[model samples]
Target: MTDSTHTIHPVWLRATHWLNALAVVTMTMSGWRIYNASPLFDFKFTKAITLGGWLGGAIQWHFAAMWLLAANGLVYLLCNVGTGRIVRKFFPLSPRAIVADLRAAFRGRLSHADLRQYNAVQRATYLFVIADAVLLVLSGLVLWKSVQFPLLRELLGGYEAARLVHFFAMATMVAFVAVHLAMAALVPRTLLAMIRGR
Candidate 1:
């Protein structure tokens, strides 16, 4: 067996991963505040878990975080593509593989013996998250400037529809974060590998 202490996450991966985590947390909190300002649903996130004291303040925070997320995400993607990590680590995914891995995971039979390789479930989740983030950014742009982003606005079914899309995208990201944290806890060494790059 290879030494688990060997580099698993490269420096760039570690940096971008943590930066993305920060941006996601910041955006989610501020977004909750924004949602409370004009909720589409009956429920609202309490102030204790949300950032920004008011609507305007929340908008500012959310926009700021959005830029951070966008920039960091771009860098991460470029590095992944440049290094061929995107194809090596996340490709060859199939529906059957995902289903098999997911069942194994639920049955506590899945392996984390290889930190450098992603199981099919991980590949699908990460890919979905990447797509979801892109959707969030586009929908957010539509909501922030409907007239300025007429093409995106129309594609998303207009301003009001864009708002729903953004909200749901945010919700999906939050759920992913929750599961990610839980999985990290369940496999503490994986967290260490991320932090220590091994």
Candidate 2:
């Protein structure tokens, strides 16, 4: 392909990507604050203290960010599919090459194509993150309004089970974001590519 044919991610994607990041991070923070209300992971077995300020306020932020995040995700998915970006990027590939990609990535030999350095680990991590996001949202709905989503609650094994999945998903996503940030900082040029759409 010529220089003109180079695949620069569309502006819509770049905008939505950053917006989604903001929304998710906001929601995660507020969600953690509220989780202190019950403390799934950090919940003390002793006394309940409104550690972050107020439960109601944290919930307010959670719901507000949820709407924005959902909107951002919908547009990202729709446009990527409608424009063939998904097909181009997510299509099935050979196991052999995937293994080679990982070996190369760890060996510091993998020069990313089009500035997207998703070797095996990245590809798998991204795929799981998307799946986990869907699960987190669905499980959240079940917990948010169990009466309205009884079937979903049942599918999740129960209200408590759904909550457990939601909690773990949030924790996992935070870890992923931390690792992602570390990688981004380690490769400043890679970050520039994302912004410049190279």
- For TM-score, the strongest prediction is 1
Candidate 2 lDDT trough over 10 residues, lowest sum: 43-52
**Clashing residue pairs in candidate 2 (N, C-alpha, C atoms within 3 angstroms):** 39-43
Clashes of each: 0, 1
Residue 196, candidate 2: alpha-carbon lDDT: 70
Once fitted onto the true fold, the runs of candidate 1 whose alpha carbons sit more than 4 angstroms away are 1-5
For model 2, residues 1-198, the per-residue Cα lDDT tens digits are: 326355355578789879989888788877777776777663432323222357788788888888888888889889978988776766555677788878987798877555643556666777778787888889989988999988999999999898889988987888889988988897776677667766
- Writing each residue's lDDT as its tens digit, candidate 1 over 1-198 gives 546457798889999999999999999999999899888999999999999889899889999999999999999999999999999999999999999999999999999998998999999999999999999989988988999988899999999999999999998998999999999999999999999887
Give RMSD to native, each candidate.
Answer: 2.3, 3.7
Clashing pairs in 1: none
